[model samples]
Target: MSSQASLRPAVVLSLVLVVWALTGLTHAQPKASVLDFSASLGNLLPSLSRPANSSRIFYGVMFDAGSTGTRIHVYTFIQKDPEELPVLDNEMFHSIKPGLSAYADMPEMGGYTVRQLLKVAKKTVPRLEWKRTPLVLKATAGLRLLPSEKSQALLEQVQDVFDESPFFVPDDSVSIMNGTNEGILAWVTVNFLTGHLYAETRETVGILDLGGGSTQITFLPKSKKTIGSSPDDYIARIDMFNSTYELYTHRTCIKYLLCHVIHRPPYIIVLLYTPGLEWRVFKSSCLPKKFREEWSFGGLTYIVSGKPDGESYVGYKLCYQEVLKVVKDIVHQPYELKDTSVFYAFSYYFDRAVDAGLIDRTQGGMLEVRDFKKRAKEVCNKMSKYRPINPFLCMDMTYITCLLKDGFGFKENTVLQLTKKVNNVETSWALGATFNHFQNLKIHR
Candidate 1:
């Protein structure tokens, strides 16, 4: 037989494998509109030649439009069989600075920014599979802080871009996620990636997500006091993978810790702008005695500094008092938090820990709550030296220390695992959101 004729059978076999892998079943139904020609070849194959589908691979692209930056997570997943959940094979991640919220005034520019990131996805997903890949963008506290009209404009612009792209876009492709869902999804991502979801013991770690405009604390309450004492809105029920989790979620203001505190409200601060007062400054004991600078957040700039006339004591004690005002009386202490429950801190939590040199940036380590207090004192007292490295380090550290002790009511010796990634996947809500999208689309089935 000729070489060309012999190669034809191998090509036919390869086509059959591709079809089986895409469809996931030997008895095919109507071809899904999302799949292209190659995925619909199952009907042409002879019944005797059909083989059981062993493994199938798919892709999902999720964009995390955060306060500080925009990140793209292109996830590759593999399924061993039709009845099983897809396993995360690998992730292609990239980021750009100054978040989408930065373009509130110029929304088209924000769309262009998203377009730039989509190039990464285009390069990562195969050309033949582009039409089937799902594209989604979920904005966090940064965009949530914007005026309703402004945020909607940004989302509309992003939707326009998604409409133009070759990838599959759902009806609710781009939107700002509420704080409660954000916390729950992060918890899901951590527990799922950590193998705690399928564990027989039902032990799961809590998540502390500190962001630019706000912060979230989510965990499964071991004690009845935590559930009974919490406000009705603070508890949320999440149904996933045939299990229901009654999670306790708390959304608090952390923006003042990052930017400037405008007014001394109870738990949250209402941001206001004065037209002609550039010299007006917000004072905080958490800052160095002589520190004065201009800081910005949520598209507004504020002058903030330490009190120049106060007593010459600037350390953890005073800084903790200043930070305490932001969290005390506002945050409820969960009964289980005082015990040995492990907590994973991320976002600004991980960043501040690394900035204070309490943990390594690459290989994160475990540290007790007292460790943050110790480091806060050192950073606050030695501000002259570390100021150039990060002017806000002292305030940030003090706030974190205060947030843990007085805010969330963690014990002094309570351990916190600081990490930015788990199993090479980002410790963010993006992964869980991607999984949710896949489930909603029924792509796995």
Candidate 2:
């Protein structure tokens, strides 16, 4: 509950690095390891620190602290590239299993903790030497979901690890935005690689990034330039398009099933693909009309029922009756349903050993991959005719879009798809390029 303003700027700033180091303490080794991926850092230097000084090497670090473990990214900016820069030399990324209880004990982090993180970081990269590299640490939704005091204490502890405090807390908003931005870049990168949008296709692209706890959709506008009369001139200028991040929407979990269901902290879902029945029998069906009225959302509930055999979900029949019962219970609560919501059901992906055919596919129509789109389109049309306005939009992350609009040039009136993909380990060279520039700069109190 302590106000950051009450603390002296020096103290506040000093705590930043200290807390960073304390969090690093959780990276107890043997159980923990670090991975580094490289990227071009030339453009990102300005955002990390001031480039006015011709002297001093500037370095930056991106940290992802979660409930399970922590990951750190180290970036360097060299003094040679004072203003206009390109081509970063080195990048490092790593993960550490810093024990949870270790962080809980600290009243606040201090210089000692930072030294520990540095030691671990150096150990991971034996050849590398860090002198006066500035470090920035950020936490994720895992830390935010914890108790306020615990979270603040953890932050304060981590702050003690650095010469300067971390620039920001790794809130869900930031994570969602980061994932969103990365998704946009990834989609562009993938599309460019796939030859979807080439010299001929000059249309702007939109990226949708849906993450574990967040969703982001971005719009990037790019323009193509035409040069000489030579037919190939256009191809030369094709890759030289001017592009900017236009619009993006970030959606983070406010009240999720994890918070609602068994409050053991983490809600886990095991996805098992059982391939036995046809695709038509495996398709999901709509909730009953009355069930829709019973719940806050007008949209029908689509359920796929399965039983967990140990860690894996196995041996299942698509029970429209049972699925409808759950949905009806969710909608009407105590009210008993006269007519069930399971109008249709599928038998696809059900374990062959424990399979019991429930619905006759010929009698009651089933969904297939090809016809699913048509069914969805029909549903959309029907909903539009009845509801006119989609109510789900009201529950999305519209406020965050407004915040990034001016900063990133987001636009309005665009429909975007959001998807999330896990990246194994990729380093951004930008960190090393930027950090190397100021690695030797001493912090003045």
Candidate 3:
């Protein structure tokens, strides 16, 4: 099995090399004789001209830099139709021990460290036509939180390995933008799954993306009508849409708190898309310091509020005094809490004595039902009054769903999975990043 596995990579490598050789030969031939060569090259050459359809599919390296470690995805675009962008030959490279930080003291997570990652990629994709197909290095909250010097040092290290360097080495800002794009794409795909395409040409769309470290909510008003009828229709469609990604600390609330303690944030917020049930995590700077250890609903519960006498499925029993104390401590941090008037509203399936009458209907809105959009607008409008100085937002499923509904105004029919049933999503993060080989990728000038 070991020998066969080793041979498998070699065979694949050899095939890529042959394609490179053929590409070189084809380019060397005169432009006029290209038609004559087509007759000989046959159907294979047809795809060669367009890398999207070629045997040498366009490859992309996505490193979701988190506070603890970086999750890297190496995949290729193998979809034939633009409307259907799929991924192929996908593999994830993980470095769990050492975080994405460039500090020399940390333990090495993988054999190929961050510095070595670029070198390995350049070597692995030997004939990678960087000019035609550029490699994108996107950082999320990890890069954002990294000191300028450290981030630059990491980028320089990666840049050193490139022969024909990548066209774009975007900063955390760009990563945040891409993260937003991914969320919007997921929302659109969800809409597609529900058989609800755009109801109006100038339709309002909201996108909320929860990643390992950060969570972003993008809200767009009615815009002009545009159609993507080309081969790359799907990307065009996504491009036409606007996006905003909220950056938290890292992928998990635990990591977010850890990074937050040191004044760091994750690079971007990504919604982990899986085959079965979907799940999302909100960026909560308010996540208790206790979560720095392993996360548990109980730990999260104690931090947000004091100990509860009985279990109430949605968050802890409301102790206004206790919850207020915690919120005050968080408010004392460097960044000023913006809108003092905007109230912090806790949602519940059933009303408790402390929460029942306290929700200020005159000053703000209180939500009880599952109408997501209605609830979100109330929070956004109410929160706006507070003038929150920090970008970080704290929310549970009730708030998150509201944000996804009202902040982004996602179509009502968007598929939503119950929190209790989140485990139904069969594919784990490790599997999607490491072994999934059917994702569609693309490149544009």
Candidate 4:
């Protein structure tokens, strides 16, 4: 709410990050211990800061306060000549575990994580550019799921840390980003990297980003009926690359089963795999009945298990039925999905597909809606075979299938391009968000 202004600016996507060095792994990335990971990230810098006099190079630091983890992205921009527009030059990325929400009761601890990631930014950016460089952080599902008082406490702590740092901290530098913006920013990043943003042709692909805390669907609706028949708020008008885009976008909750129970404050997520979740046990059909383990996420731990000795048999049918209730009637189905549209699904979508051998981990591939259904059936039927990889793989796959088909109402044959990154940068909202911040765009409703 800090940067919500009436005046808006034209977003030039051409100047966004051209290539950023990013790291990617499976559902969980770089399984390094928290101690070693923090050490590695902090010690990567050759010097405290590089001294440079030329103003041709610009730096921006963006911290992604995600539900699963906290990551820092340092982006460098260069303009060869004063008349020419700036383009991306270089970037560095790193992350730490247990998102900000995990420290709901201990806001200072959350600030410590931000402080640690800030060190990476200092080492990445030049000393001369520190004062001019913008440092900002936007939180996603994790903090959004916490109690208002608790989430606000966490943000305030982060703001304090940002102010103490040498980098420039603009108004609303640390805040919880709405899900709709998350989806739209991602649309910008993907379209630009995929050649749709700057191309003469206006053809752009739809995007589906399913994170642990929230899920988003955004696309340029081709059919008039879609815009006319849908809810008024689902339609958003924005300017990008000097063109106006009336995109059909919606932000839906998909944090395990917590999406529906959002009205209950002091929120809690279901079926998350994290550390220190040993207090309570959660049972779901998504896992094998005989399976039992400790799952952790958002700073809390819970004992998770499939139905015990007396529970009914667990398989695709049962798992789908259980996860279906979480999305039924709650998610809106836009018209014209079967024709004239292509979609790119990433985040949890790509991770689960990789776990099921449905796509290559390195180079993502395409798949029909039914491919998920088929894989979900195979994995759920033989949980033993896939359980070694991830105990919740069957449930997660089933959830994706249900979300695409029943939730968003996509046709079974609808083609979805699954990828983790495009053009060397991670396929995320960070780049698009950075563009919005670098230009100081207002957050308009």
Please list the residue runs of candidate 1 whose C-alpha ends up more than 4 Å from where it truly belongs after superposition.
1-53, 83-85, 254-284, 294-303, 307-312, 441-445
Q: What would the per-residue lDDT of candidate 1 be over residues 122-171, giving only the tens digit for each residue?
A: 98888866776778899986787788999999999999999899987766
TM, every model: 0.79, 0.37, 0.39, 0.75
lDDT of each: 0.70, 0.29, 0.30, 0.72
Poorly placed runs, candidate 4 (over 4 Å): 1-55, 254-326, 442-444
- Model 3 TM-score? 0.39
Worst 10 residues of 4 by lDDT: 1-10
lDDT of 3 by residue, 29-48 (tens): 21122123222222222243
Candidate 1 TM-score versus the reference: 0.79
Q: Where is model 3 poorest over a 10-residue stretch in terms of lDDT?
A: 1-10
Query: In candidate 2, how many clashes are counted?
Result: 71
Error of 4 at 40 (Å): 35
Q: Which run of 10 residues does model 1 get worst, by summed lDDT? A: 1-10
**Between the candidate structures 2 and 4, which one is better when assessed by TM-score?**
4
The per-prediction CA RMSD against the true structure, in angstroms, equals: 8.9, 19.4, 15.8, 11.6
Candidate order by lDDT, decreasing, is 4, 1, 3, 2
